[model samples]
Target: MSTNPRGPNAIDRHVGSRVRLRRQLLNMSQEKLGEELGVTFQQVQKYERGANRIGAGRLWTLARVLDVPVSFFYEGVSETLNQPGFAEGDQTPIIDDFIQSADGVQLAQAFARIRDSKVRRRILELVRTLAAEEAEAQAAESEQA
Candidate 1:
């Protein structure tokens, strides 16, 4: 064995925090969520603490149970949006704001309904392109300020 110890970093903690927050907002108990996910409450605790990695399949199941997209865990989590990342405590408020948005919830639902991998990739690409364009526009506006 390589004796490598697995541990979550700042980003993982951020994702976990988002998951916990959404669960709370939906008035879900960790035990209830675990029952839905076929996991133990302890496992749910691990996920909420970022003590274990959530696999893609498990994440998908979680999204369904949470009534959100897998991407919902990552919203408001970009490095640019959070200075010093989650470690500096800057992203929590942003994540909370994102979770409260109707548009964000709609987007999450739309993302969850996309089954085709290629279509999902295309959607991500399109969103990235749109975000880039928006950023450019913002930059232009700032320059004129």
Candidate 2:
């Protein structure tokens, strides 16, 4: 891969896009996230623009506040490292799309409102089962193709 100091790394840009997408999905403004993180909005903007590196501590805090795994930012990034910028061939992190939907936000809010541990566990189990079934179905389809 060609190294250019002025150009942003594809991984960095992708991760920044994911972070910005998630922040928007949660209806969070950069100012709000900055307030929560005890930083200026400009700093948050820099992070989102990939102009500044996000530190591990800040990433952890961002994950906690955003209700996602730290891996969420890096998901699908490996395949695009050599690309100059994110391209259509690279996987568009599905979580970003899912969480950006209105239904997704509602579902997340509803889940958060559920105070019972047992119910939460059951919900998690049900989601897992559904996801597994969907994966199996997709695999079967691909096999037939």
Q: Work out the TM-score per prediction.
A: 0.53, 0.53
Candidate 2, residues 90-136: lDDT per residue as tens digits? 44446545654557767887899999999999999999999999999
- Give Cα-based local distance difference scores for all models: 0.78, 0.80
Cα RMSD (Å) per model? 11.6, 9.1
Clashes of 2: 0
Ten consecutive residues with minimal summed lDDT in candidate 2? 91-100
Backbone clash numbers for all candidates listed: 0, 0
lDDT of 1 by residue, 22-108 (tens): 887677888999999999999988887777878889989989999998898887667534664357655556655565455665577
Off by more than 4 A, model 1: 1-5, 79-145
Looking at candidate 1, the ten consecutive residues that score lowest on lDDT are: 77-86
Screening candidate 1 with a backbone cut-off below 3 angstroms (N, C-alpha, C), the clashing residue pairs are none
